[model samples]
Target: MSAFPQPAQPSLFGDDGPLRDTREPVLMSLNPVYYDLIWAGEKTYEFRRRFLTGQSVRWYVYLTGPVGRLGAVIDLGPAVVDAPEQIAEIAERTRAGNGASVFEYVRDLDQAFAIPIQRVAEYPGMPLEQLRTELGGFHPPQGYTRLRNHPDLLSICEKVRADSVRREMTVPGH
Candidate 1:
């Protein structure tokens, strides 16, 4: 529930210059983002706010486990992307013996890890072939969870497409 759906500009918009990333399997999910003033000030006005507030704890409450804050492992294992402390919190919840909480937590993690990584990229750079491989067989189905959970795949895909542009920039045209 970010206050912003899409950033007003791309991460590379400012000529602070493109980051020199030549590594494959670049894990962009862990990258940090800037917060708007209100969000930065602890207003908790984003979609995730529902959990942070008492209104609804289920959103991220999986990290806390049932019966209120179980253990670290139970919560952390399910998290596709979270801090070490958060993972630890989940594990702790598992030890507390919350059957419902532990079950919910484990399910989410499996979903995250099983996610076809190809979805991490988009049209231009989205490792389409890679996705097909991970997804199994040719032509992945629409509404793939890999695409749903990892939206960054689109931006990464677009950025990767720029590679051909880079090559064309230097190579002599036919």
Candidate 2:
């Protein structure tokens, strides 16, 4: 017998249909510093130069550089597109002392996107080396890549999502 018990498989469908029918899955690379803030729940909004609006998105967060791993999945609400200054105002309102740098990042842009973080699920992580080995070769995205475009990556994300679901179900008071 195996030393560890296998986790229960997550159901793909609910009463309506697939559980993830509403949100599109996408892989997004984040700086280790910013990822740390998100992990700590200090960062509530993710500011981007551009992103999909009017729809929810599930972000498979890949921490770049030394970490070089996909460590967490974040469920994001619809993007709030607005002027850079206005986006900065949101950062300042939500979390003090965060607006200045956020403004700096998007100052040159005509419009920016403020993606609200709804939930975060952390996993053990998949390193870059392992990902490259599994998918033949993997290139971390500069912006974002739709999971649908890459079947292998999509499968990996699905497994992570399933694992997260299982973990949540098993947790007390979930």
Winning candidate number (lDDT): 2
lDDT score, candidate 2:
0.82
Task: Give one digit per residue, the lDDT tens place, for model 1 in 53-154.
Answer: 111111111011122210110011111334333433443443333334333444444221111111111112233355445435333222211322445543
Query: What TM-score does each of the candidates earn?
Result: 0.17, 0.81
Report model 2's TM-score to 2 decimal places.
0.81
lDDT of each: 0.25, 0.82
Q: What is the lDDT of residue 142 in candidate 2?
A: 92
| Candidate 1: regions farther than 4 A off | 1-22, 26-137, 141-160, 163-174
The root-mean-square deviation over C-alpha atoms between each candidate and the true structure, in angstroms, is 19.7, 9.2
Query: Where does model 2 exceed 4 Å of error?
Result: 1-12, 15-20, 164-174
Q: Candidate 1, 73: how far from true, in Å?
A: 29
Model 2: per-residue Cα lDDT over 1-174, one tens digit each: 889997755565652434435788899999989876765657888899989989999899888999998878888889899999999998887779999989998999999999888777778778999888888999999998989888889997776556533121111111
